[model samples]
Target: MANVIEEAKSGRASCRTCKKTIAKGELRLGVEQMTQFSDTPSMQWHHLLCAAGKLPGELKGALAGYEGDVPNRADIDKAMTDSIKSGKAKPGAFPYIDKAPTGRAKCMQCDETIEKDSWRVAVERELEVNGFMRKSPGYMHPKCVAPNLENVGGTMEDLVSQVKTNSLIDEADMDAVVEEMTGEGGGDGGE
Candidate 1:
């Protein structure tokens, strides 16, 4: 392997396939095409995978006589993952969270169109400093959490602010509730 520092000092090199001299400070990778212009040279331009003998046999078999390097598993995986993440591969076999694209769900407060999976709750704040003031603190979908507050509208904000000071009132007394409504947990004494 040629030292990158040494190659940089020597300056321009050409891609074997294009025969164009690559200028200084050009971003390049080992597998990217390159050539050595010499009257008599032992070294020759080789596809990085072919030179490294890293090409998978199955991929090579699929290519038949095509000599160029095929993408490795990591490259293929990254591309697939990127496709899934970018919404380009709908119904792809992405291993992460399952996604179902429903139409936009309007925010109760701001009314901004949010993806069904990207809704947020704007809880009102009740605590006032110096005077009575209200504010809405937005709670967001797991995925769209970062920008939840930005989309809140005036009406929703007021509602959210009003809610902050009020504790939730539940009519049902959970402590006095039976463990089971069915025969289990002594709900009914069996014969």
Candidate 2:
């Protein structure tokens, strides 16, 4: 029902994080996922190390309650800590601010490339894919966030609160993002 750490009963499960099969008897992290087909949630399996990198917070909680021996416990713990500090492990859902890992993503509002290592905002946007509409994270420059949200019937106040709650970035980076969003600090006037 909840996230768990357990030995793989068989080699049939592939890790959701790495898309690799977990050998039988290997320790795996199981994150409970809700499926549209059923009321009961199913477990999504991940290799212990992979889970540590991708689902650090969830894995940490499950690891805390597990009674069995975990090989490389120290290594896993270190990886989880590093992941959190790097902002690579997202703590919550959309509407967060993080440094862009790469420069490939363009800002949805201004149609400008979000340079690597620069602050960017992520918001949920609906897209039509293969004739079906799906919601996915859309990236935007910090300055463009307010205007884009306002254009879409979203409020800056609500967004600022969500970003504060959801962002994994440190205090300094968060302050910069908030200032840019509110136009309180000099942000090139979002030119």
CA lDDT scores, all candidates in order: 0.31, 0.81
lDDT per residue, candidate 2, 1-191, as tens digits?
Answer: 37789999999999998899999999999988999999999989999899888887677667756999999898997888788887657654556788889999999899989999999988887789999998787999888977787543568877876666556667677878889877787644422
Worst 10 residues of 1 by lDDT: 174-183
Residue 149 C-alpha lDDT in model 1: 35
Candidate 2 least-lDDT 10 residues: 182-191
- What is the model-wide C-alpha lDDT for candidate 1? 0.31
What local lDDT does model 2 show for residue 48?
A: 88
lDDT of 1 by residue, 24-90 (tens): 5432223222346544423223232232233222122223223444446355434433433454332
Reference-based TM-score, model 1:
0.17
